[model samples]
Target chain A: MIEQFFPNVNWDTMFEATYETVYMTAISVAITAVLGILLGLLLFLTSKGNIWENRGVYAITSVLVNIFRSIPFIILIVLLIPFTRFLLDTIRGANAALPALIIGAAPFYARMVEIALREIDKGVIEAARSMGASMTTIIFKVLLAESKPALVSGITVTAIALVGYTAMAGVIGAGGLGNLAFLDGFQRSRDDVTLAATIIILLIVFVIQFIGDFFTNRLDKR
Target chain B: MITISNAKKLFKTKNGSLTAVDDVSLTIKEGEIFGVIGYSGAGKSTLIRMLNGLELPTSGTVDVNGKVISGISSGELRKARQKISMIFQHFNLLWSRTVRENISFPLEIAGVRKNTREKKVEELIKLVGLDGRGDAYPSQLSGGQKQRVGIARALANDPEVLLCDEATSALDPQTTDSILELLVDINKRLGLTIVLITHEMHVIRKICHRVAVMEEGRVVELGNVLDIFKQPKEPITKRFVQQVTEPEETKETIEHLLNDYEDGLVVKLAFVGESAEQPLITTLIRSFNINVNILQGKISHTQNGAYGTLFLHLRGDVPEVKQAVEYLEKASVGVEVITND
Candidate 1:
């Protein structure tokens, strides 16, 4: 009865693929959070009227972020094959997929992080400065702390996007749910396997969103 | 003590150079509540910000408690700022921080120990009258409560001088009074010198010992609060004084009273200092043969003394009214006859 409808879905392989997908998403999201925050802080601090306002640094960073963020993810993976091979000696597994996954998603998340930082009240920063808070203190305690909820929600969105990017990375020989679905499901006409993988992917996305919303709501006092 | 000598602040804008503060020089005494009153863009904000080195004067020097705020190095200035704190018009508490945490922020910046910081935060919470709301977030507090937290934060470092930049502007009148009372209490208790800037005359009249009236990047008039209230020299100063001394409808009420009574002479009498406490109205009725009808009156108390204005209708013989006016003049009361044009 369980295997009645076009029985080609292997539970063990499906579980393995799900684990691979989760592993890729988790690692990339962690690294992306750090890199994105640094880039975002740079963009924000060097912009006009901020503490470290510098036109030259801001313009250079802005151009770099824009160039990376504007490229399509699939094209980016193809374009970064040489860099990925040089960095990791191989370009075919979950680890190989990480460089492209982080590079593709971090700038996207960096823009979100910048928007979150901008939402903080300028007066809060001034009040900190009036207390003689050093720049490091302002950045960590005031700017980042005040914008925590926005930053969490921004990273949540970025995390979900990275999950999707991981699947896209799986298309180019990076093993994950996408690789299993394409090679063993679509190629072999096993509709049930593809349906199973889709279900698992949707479940993963829903769980990430639920966790993100919980933390965001808990952090937001305003 | 603070001394601002030949201080000037200039800004380069799209339209060219704008002088935010011109050659403004003032000496504020220790442990005194000094106030700077001005309308928007009158440079009072720039002037006060200069005292704490928040805004650097393009030309001159601001010396606060023996440290030259304008010429100090950034490292020294940061150290100076811990002793010379400022609070803003908007109660700028960090929304994410609780009242205790917000108040604890300055102490943290000053590198206070964790145990000392916690104890100081509790004491400050009590000082600002926020005893039990320490654990509540700023979002949960009212405007008045937020300001209490702001004041607590400013006081956390035991600042020698507290600069209030339109601190009560955003509060309602009742809240403004409560906050002003708190500031006065802090000033008296801690012997902290306060430099506050506001556009409201009521704030100055209530707490300020000395007041400076600013207009167009300069101090138009400066003197004791009571003296300024008694004889406002500039038109701007007079307008500010009138804010508390005269109600908005006084002119229309006088006109209406003039139309209703065609026989009496309506006169405005100003009482200042010790004279306001005397029973001059009772004396006038007993000594003269006239019917006195009180029209409108207001008395404002300053740090130095009480100042008031009273409008009266004297319906009697013209000679008796003339005698009454002379009598008021002899009693050191300011008298002006209100006549129909």
Candidate 2:
């Protein structure tokens, strides 16, 4: 009965698409995590009343984040096609879809990181300053450590968003479940194949969310 | 070893400008426990922050250990802060870290070697009476235990000065006494100059050698703790003094005594230091032909000395009562005639 319903569902192609989806999500999320954390830290330290307050750096980074966050993901993919070609010398597969995914997601994640850092108590920061801690020490030991659980939660949310973005990358012929579900299942009128792909995508999102919550709960000492 | 000369702070709020710390000057000697007491928004917080260079004074200068802390560059101010540490009412401990890690934080920031840091943290844990609870996070500890961690962390660098910003305000009365005892112990052992900012008069009375009473943005009264308790000049200082003496109840009690004993003089007497513990009431009866009846009395200790107040009923001839009152006054006791019935 299963074979009759999913006659067009090639297991080998489905597995390959699954691999591509994970690959694109992993690489892009990894890049976005590092760049986003740095961008977020810059925004935090240079905020108007922080210990390292610098108006110029704060204003510039805030505008940059706002501009990138304003663009729709589909338009962003098309917009970065020329730059993707220039960077990777190709614009055809999972790897080629990465530049746009990272550029689009990192700024979104940076905003999350900023909110996480801001949630730290002002008194805690003053306590560190009173102890003669340097800016570097505060950022690493106090601010980052205190915000760890929140940062993990932020990263989890970002990772889930990146998963969706990678599937959307199918518009550029990126070989993920999105491409398979859109062209092979939907275009071919194989509604059963589309339903199977949808189930798998839902399962991936649940897994990511579950892992994020587990880590957040374990790390939150407060 | 700290001096402030006409220090002031102005904050630019949405409404024009507000003076947080009005022009004020103070000098704190080494090994002295100086207290600043004020209600909220009275500039006590700003005054304490200025000593550690956390808040820069808009004018005047703050000199600590021969260094001008006000208006200094961030790097220089940070270096100065190494010799001065502070604790908070909330404890302000890093919730993610264990007690030992929190204590070692300053040592780590100062770049003390790992082995030395471990040794120092262990010593501090014992010093603050944490002992086997070193591995416990702040969330697991009680309020008193958290403040112990705060004290240990503040003392990690063996700082010359420890500033306490409403350190006991969040504590219960019993816990506050324990913390105050711990502070007094640390003060004596290390001879560290402690500047305590509190709105609680019991805190000032129990540990401070001298106190500055702040109102609005100015120092309304500054004197030795015993003196402030015995002879408070400002209305704010008098209210603070009443916190320790229970003056409101005493006043009612005095009225009750006055009504009951209509033929005697109702007198209120205050004694300072050794005079409070003296057998002066007996001496008044022995030396003069007067029958003295005690109405209300209490004796409490300050870091400087003991202070006491007494309400007395003198039922003797009016001439003998007047002589007894003069005799008590001559002995350097503070005497006030509440009523001459």
Candidate 3:
């Protein structure tokens, strides 16, 4: 019954496509989370009278984040295509789309990360400083640790957002569930394929969300 | 010793430049609990921060352990900060780190090894009487417990000087007492030079050996606790004393009190040091044989010792009362004639 579709069900092709989707989302989320959190921390600390207080630095970073965040994902893909191609060699494939995914998600992730970091108790930072902690020590030990729960939650936001961006990336030549649905289900009149793709994407979202919530709950004791 | 000489801190505000600390010069001796008493924003905090270079002096210098802290660079300033541990009014323990981790933070910064840090942290926990709360997070602790962790953290590096900026202001009265008691105990045991900033005179009275009263970014009165409490020169200091003890019979109170003048004299006698506890009233009665009626009295202890004041109305012969007052004066008790009532 399952093999009735295209002679042998194209199991290898489906598996490869799903693997590409997972690889893209995993790599993009990891890179974006780390870089975004770092940028967000620099933004927060620079503004918050830690080590270096540069109003110019803060203004620049703040404007940059907002600008990146405001641009639509599709336009960003097209606009960044030249740069992405320069960086990754092929703008119309899976490997190349990862860079765009990172670019699209970093600013969004950073916004959430900044908000999360800023929400930590000010007293906690003051405590660390008073205890003779250097700027670096305070960042890694106090700021990041205290902001961990929110960071986890921020990562969750970034992941979900990245998933949406990943699906959108399918509009370009990046292969993912959305491309499968669009190319094989919507563009072709295959209702069963569309239903299957929709169900699988939903499952992935639920799994990611559940893992996010669980870690967030565990780390969040405030 | 902590020497702050002509130290100034000016903050640039929207309205204008405001001085938080104004060329403050003071010294906190070794093994003494010195209190910098002030209302909020009175520059006590700024002064304390200047001690370890957390807040740099706009002009002047703070020499701790003979090192000019204000002239040093940021790295050296941080290293200097290790020798002078500061506790906050807010009990600023890191929320993410366990109480043990928070306590060991300074030690960790100073490059103590892990096993050594763990043992030291345990010892500090025991010292602060938080023996079982080593693994608890700041959120899991109460306000008092949090401050205890703060105290432990402050003591992590075994600093020569411990600066407390309104350390008891956020605590309940009972908890404040215990914290004060713990400070006193730490002072005695470690001989740690404690520079405590507080608005509460009672807190100073509890543990401070000497105190400086700050107001509007200036130290108005500076002396030992007993001297400051007994003969507070500044109006702000007097107001603070009045909170704990009744305000002594002022000229106004005396005028109101002296409305009905009697035959005898009303004399205000003050006691300090040995005179404070002496049986002066009994001696007065025995020598002058004057009928004494107590009108008003106030007693307080300072760093030097117990010092106080007593206002009395002598109801016998005027000349006898006068003679009794003179005798009281001769015995080293300060006597002020409030009125001849």
Against the native complex, each candidate's DockQ, computed on alpha carbons, is 0.83, 0.80, 0.61
Candidate 2 lDDT at A125 equals 95
Instruction: Report the C-alpha lDDT of model 3 over A1-222, residue by residue, as the tens digit.
Output: 666754422567566667777878999999998889888987887784555678999899989988988899989988888898899788776777887789888988888777887887777777677767888898888888888888888888788878778777876879887777678777877776666666767777788999999998998766
Query: Over the stretch B254-287, how does candidate 2's per-residue lDDT look in tens digits?
Result: 8777777778788888899988888998798899
DockQ of 2: 0.80
lDDT of each: 0.93, 0.91, 0.83
Off by over 4 Å in 3: A1-15, B247-269, B284-299, B309-324, B336-341
Tens-place lDDT per residue, model 2, A46-79, is 9978877999989999999999988999899999
* lDDT tens digits, residue span B84-191, model 1: 989999988999988988998999899999999998998888888888898999989999999999999999899999999999999999999999999999999999
Regions of candidate 2 where Cα sits further than 4 Å from its true position: A1-5, A54-60, B256-263, B286-291, B339-341
Worst 10 residues of 2 chain A by lDDT: A192-201
Of 2 and 3, the candidate ahead on TM-score is 2
Candidate whose lDDT is highest? 1
Candidate 2 chain B: minimum summed lDDT over ten consecutive residues — where?
B246-255
Docking class of 3: medium
